[model samples]
Every structure is written in C-alpha cells, then in structure tokens.
Target: MLRGTAAVSVQRLAPEDLGPAAADCVFEALAARPKPVIGVATGSSPSPLYQALAASPRDFGSATWFALDEYVGLPQGHPESYAEVLRREIIEPLGLDPRTVHLPNPHTGDHQAACARYEQQIAEAGGIDLQILGIGRNGHLAFNEPGGALDSCTRLETLTEDTRSANQRFFDSPEDVPTHCLTQGLGTILAARHLLLIAQGAGKAEALRAALKGPVSRDCPASVLQLHSRVTVLADAEAASLL
Candidate 1:
C-alpha cells in the first residue's frame, strides 16, 4: 500500500499480467458478498479484465453491474454508446442477467432527473463494492473532466475536445462523437468501498504520474484518487513509466 500523501496501492506489471491481477480483485469482492454491486468501466483499458472475468468458470450471475458513464445523444442500440459497449464486452459474455445491469439513461428529456434517479438507484443498492476505473488522457475519471468540482455528484457534463478526439475512433467520424455525457462524479465514485484503476500504453504515462504523484486538484481530476483510502492502481510498464 502506498503511504505519505497518497493512500493508494500501486502495482506496476507487464501488459499481459494485468488481467489476472485485476480479476483477483473482482473474485475477492465476489467472495465477500453474495450479490456484490460491481461498478464497471468502458474503455480499452478494461477490456482484458472483462475478458478474464468472462473466461473464468466461477459464477457471476449474482452480481449487479453499474456502468460509469454514457454518451447523452446516442440512441439505445447505437454501437458506440456505453450501454451497448458494456452489453457486448461484459454482460452477454459473462451471461449476467440484463435486469441486473444499470446505466445512466441518455435518452431522457430531463437529464438532471435521470442523473438524480441513477444516484438513488445506487444508494438503494447499498453503494458499490468495487469500482473498476480508467483514467482519461487528460486525467478525467468517468466523464468528470478537469476543472470539475471535487464534490460534484451524478450529473451531466461537457466533454473536453481532447476527450472527444480520443473517443473518435469508436465513431464513424470525429463529428459523431457526442459532446455531452452523463457520469458518476468524483464524489460518487469515492463512495465505493474499493476502487481498481487500470491503465496501459505510453499515452497514459503522464496522466498516471500526475494522478499518483501530484497534488490533489481540479486541474487533474484523477489526482483525486489520492484522497480515497482503498485505491488499487494496476498500470502496465508504459503507463507507469513516468512514475
């Protein structure tokens, strides 16, 4: 476990080794609860971990899943929407019940109401047991971009240009990337009992370093992880290179 100003445990590992190590965290959470509420993330960084969980023989039918964020304007079945992404990458593969999965409603006319309702749902579920996270290149967590208030709750947010550009690959063209998103805020994420952050590639190194080593500030939202008591960061060599 890391000490000093940061209250996290950092593990630097080879890219191929990240999946099993992260799976161990999920297994432990499952062992501790009959119906664990697992917070799920969508991105390339978590793909390997999801694949590892799907390949495991252990039953995951009892777990409840909540997605971290979703694009606001996308249709229900849009392939690039976070909901569809989660369904394709984890839900169907793991054979988890569709009824047990939850995500922020992107199609609602009143997005604020939807965000509030999502928060209520999480609170009713007794909060998340384990939250899997991936830091953005700009140090955002979920869609809580840089400069966002540290205590912000579940809400809608405007994505940064960098965020949109980074996500453009998922869409047919850069213009198709949604500008706004609904996300679980830094405050909401900190409510989870445990947090597991997975990052890879050299592109993530600078942000990872700032998140782990820099002062807690809105300038680098991922740096807020330093305030959490039970954060476990699993970074491949390239991501941890600056650390």
Candidate 2:
C-alpha cells in the first residue's frame, strides 16, 4: 500500500487490497517484537485489514489490543457501536482472548475516569506497537475533529454534524447516531511507535490530499501525523488523485 507522499511512505492500492496489506504488516510487526500491542480502529474502512489478519497463519494468542474510540452513550450491544464491530470483526476472528482486548467503557457514570483508566491500561500493557487509523471526510482521526488541540489526550468529545452524518450508516437513522464520543486524543494516538492510515474510494481523495499536502492544523486533525516518526499511508487511485 505505500505510493507517492514523501513525508510518510504512501502506497496506493484498490479498496479490496487493504486486508492482505494489513495482515502482512501485522505479521511483520509481530515477528519483529515480543507480545506486540496492536491498536485497532473501528469502521467500514478497516474491515478488510481485520479480515486479512484473521486469515494469516501467525497466532495472535499473546497479543494485546486496544480500541481507538467508542461512542459516548451507546450500549455495548448496539449494532452501530465500534466496540461491537471490533469484537466481531477483529477480536473474534484473530483468536484473541476477549480479556486482552481493551475498550473505553461508556457505560460508566464517570466518563473522565473511564478515559484515565483506559489510558492507564494501555500504559501498563507497555504501549501500542502499531496503530491503525481511518481518515474522516473532515480530516479527523478517531473523534479528534476540527479545533482539537495538538497535545490533547484521551477524553470525551462532541461529534460534529459532518462526522455524525458520515456515521449514520451504522445506526437505524441519522437521529440514532450519537452526538458525542470518547476517543483517543491526538497526542495519545501519536504516541504509538508506528501508524498505518488507510483510505480508499473517490470520496476520500480530497481529505487524503489535505492530510498529505496541506499544512498541519487542528482543522485537519490527521495532519498532525506529519510530526510522527513512522507513518504509512495507503490509498486507492481515487484517494491518491491529489497526491
């Protein structure tokens, strides 16, 4: 998946190509380290990556995993929830023990406490080795939308109308979409040793271009990746058109 952006190694590939590419990277990372901690994102975009990892021959028995974000008030069993999606697509197929999968609990009455506890859990697991991401149409990463601070940490955030619209597919109706979320902060995400941001389809071309070619700004949260030491961006022709 690595193509044309020089700041970070960019690879352009078709939408379907995401799965095997992710599997290969996960395998390579696992082989290169001991008990690798993998941070996963939830959405339609990363489904292929999870599939590829599941189909791989490598065993993920000892690996630790963390989710990048979760809707603030959604129940764990909600079909539109990221936690449920990750459990079905990534956790189950990869043979990971459910106990090793860490996700921010939105059910807690103290939301800030949940974020702190989740951060601590990751720290105790020795931090994430690799973090997978998907760019929002508005250039957000997780729920770190426009105006997000450069050094923000894990916390609750309000979802923008654009983000809520984009995520409507997960819910029965646009109104069913949660207006807020608990997401890993820009700083928290950047702490990962490596980042793999994947995008595909003509719809993402503009955001991909902005994230790669545009100046860093809170207006485009993903643009902060430019400061990271290691980042791999994968896009399809439509998404790579700007590059």
Candidate 3:
C-alpha cells in the first residue's frame, strides 16, 4: 500500500510486469460479476493491460464499458479520438459489443445536457463495478486536468499544454490536436465501486508519488484518488521508486 495516504493498495513491479498484475485484478472482478459495468481509460500507459484483457479467456459480451473522456471538435472518424482508440485497442480485440459502450458525446451541441445524460446512463447501469485509470505525467486522470473543481461532473474543458504535448504524437502535429475535451470529472469517477489506477515507467514516478503521498488537492487532480474508499494503485518498480 502507498504510505502516508488512506488504504490505497499499491503493487510495484517492472514495466513489463504491470500488464499481468492489472489483468489478473480485472479478471477477478469480471468473474465475480455477471455483467460488469466497467470504466475504461485510453492513452499509451494502459495499452499493456488492454492487450492482456483481449488475450484473456473471459467473455465480455455482456459487459458494459464506459470511456473516461474524448476530445472535442475532432472529426467523426479521427483516429486519435478516444472512441476510435477504444475500438482498435479494446472493443475489437476483446469482442465487446459496440452498442454497450458509452462515451461523453463531444459532438453534442448541448454539452451540458450530454454530460447529464451520460451520468444518468451510468447510474442506470448500476454504476461502474471497476474503473481503470491512467495517471498523466502531470498527475491528471484520464483528461481531468489540474486546478479544476474536484466535484465537477462531465463537461467541456480546455486542455493544458502538458496534456496537449503528451497527446500530440497521436495527431499529425502538436497544433493538430484539439485544444478542448469532454471528460468525466473527479466526482463522477469517485462513484465507481472500485478504482484501478495504473502508472508505469520512471518518467511517472514523481506524479505517482504526489498522488499517493501529497495532500488531497486539485493541483494534482489524481491526488483525489486517495479520497476513494476502494482504490488500487498499480505501478511499475520505477514508477514506485519515489514512494
């Protein structure tokens, strides 16, 4: 467990070792539930876990999935969009039904209404059984950037320079990435029954340390995970070095 915080269990392993660690936890969750309502996060950090789940023998045909966030103002079929990324990496490989997957609607004209609707949908599904998260180098979860309201719900938010730069590789150029996104807020994520926060590599060590040891504050959005009752911090040895 991470020291100096609440009961957040931490698993320190090598970068290559994180995949099986996370996959095993996810498998346990799915086996215990009939139709798991799961929240899935995107980005390179969780790729290994996604691949492991795809190769796992579990049948997720009845599972319902929710994406953490999506870029606003991107084209319908943009490859970098969270929707496409989830399809290529998770949905297709895992054989999950596309209709059962949900994401905050970036294309909706009434962004506020869309967020509310998405929240309602989650509630209707009996809330998320397990939420998978990836902490940013800046300590942001999903696209929940720093200095925002901790209780804020899903809504449009401007992207920080750090987040944009980190995500630019998926786009043609740095400027090509969208400047805004629609993300589930800290409050929304906290509603999950269980949270699996994954961080790997030495580059993420500082952020992991802050999130686990620092005070609960919006400065490091991920620090809010400490407030949750059921959170598992899965990190690589290098990422846990600072702790």
Candidate 4:
C-alpha cells in the first residue's frame, strides 16, 4: 500500500544481504531512466551497496552522479575529500565520466558563491532523479545535522560534536575533522524523485526508529524523510531492532 503520495518500503535483511538489495534498487532506477541524475551518499553503510553495483552487470555510462557533502577545509585531493572519495568509490570503479560528476566545492575561494552555483547546476540538470542516503548516528541525512531546519537547502552548516566524533575515524583525530561542511539540506534531498536510505548495525537502531516511525521533526534531521513521497529504507535486522 502507498503511504501518502509515495510508497515507503522497508526491506529487512541480514547485514551481508543488504548490498545486493540496495544495488538492485539503484540498478532499477538507472535502467528505467535516461540520463538519470544519481545522488550518491558515502559511508560504511553504503559501501557494500557500491561494491554490489561494481560487481553487477548494470552500466553507468549514461548516468550523471553527485556527492552529498564535503568537509569545509579539506584540500582538493585529500583522501577524505568527497570529490576524491566519489572518484575512487563510484566513478572510476563503474567507468563513469568524471566530467559528468558534481560535488560541493568546499575548497573554493568563495564557499558561499560555490554553493549557489552548485544549487543552480543541480536545478539546471532537472534536479536529482534518485538519491541514495545513509543515516547518521544522530539521524542526520548527509550533513543535515540534528536540529537543522527541515526546509534547508544546499549550504554550509556547522558540524555537531556527535557528527564530528562519528566522522573522526576518517581523520587523524577529532580536532582534525572539519568544524563545518557543505551539504544538501532536507529540502534539497527531498527534491529527488526517489530516495533510498540504507542502514546497518545496532549503532543506527535508534535513528532508524526515529526516521521510520517517529513524528516528523527537525530535531531528527532524517525524520524529515517521513514527509517525502517516495522513500525506500534498506536496513539490517540490527538497525531495524528499535523499530
């Protein structure tokens, strides 16, 4: 049955079983659309999904790709740079054209102007057709941290302590993590025609519960997903435990 204007489906599977399932969802979207604009999220939860896609038969030659966010102070070629990560994990592996890819430019001289241009570029491309997301331990979608405005757009946002701590693994230490980031906001994310979120492990259980079942609120940035019409949540049993 449909929930509101969109049908939300939750597929519960083992942690190892989630990659192929989510990859299948992505493949279906890509195969069904011409020049599909795909929004890619980076994280451990979606790493398996990317692996599955890399191993699949689907072709990514015709699709355009975009990354969800980037740290404010990272250098252009830093290992943790979103641009580099997308290139390594999604574009190169799939043989997709890097020229057709887009990511927020945190390294630019004028960050604010760069954000405006990024938003315009996405709009000019007809918005995103499908967006893959991973829930932060704090229920954040991309870098839309908790307590963020629900209708926010792609812009620079300060990172919360929890968010910084969670991402500290990618840096040398907590202090090495950027204090700010540029991310597509809840409104920007909801603009995508299809939204797919993947979650795994018990660490994501509480946020999964809030996003899937709790009332819509800005307190849980991901909970704003409940307002979108088309959303699919792929979760492992442990992540779905609280729900």
Q: Estimate each model's TM-score.
A: 0.97, 0.96, 0.96, 0.95
- Pairs that collide in candidate 4 are none
Q: Residue 199 of model 4: what lDDT?
A: 91
Worst lDDT 10-window in candidate 1: 1-10
**Candidate 4 local lDDT, 94-179, one digit each (tens):** 88889999998887788888888888989988889889999999899999988879998899999999988988899987778999
Highest lDDT: give the candidate number: 1
| Ten contiguous residues with the weakest lDDT in model 3 | 1-10
Flag regions of model 4 displaced more than 4 Å: 1-6
Every candidate's lDDT: 0.92, 0.85, 0.87, 0.86
Question: Residue-wise lDDT of candidate 2 within 1-243, one digit each (tens)?
Answer: 544445588888877886788677777778767788999998877888888887777789878899999997777688678777877997778877899888888899898999999899989999999899999999999889989898888999999999999988777888889998889999999999899888877778888888878898988998888888888887777888888
Ranking by lDDT: 1, 3, 4, 2
Off by over 4 Å in 1: 1-6
Model 2 alpha-carbon miss at residue 91, Å: 1.6
Winner on lDDT between 2 and 3 is: 3
Q: What is the TM-score of candidate 1?
A: 0.97
Off by over 4 Å in 2: 1-7
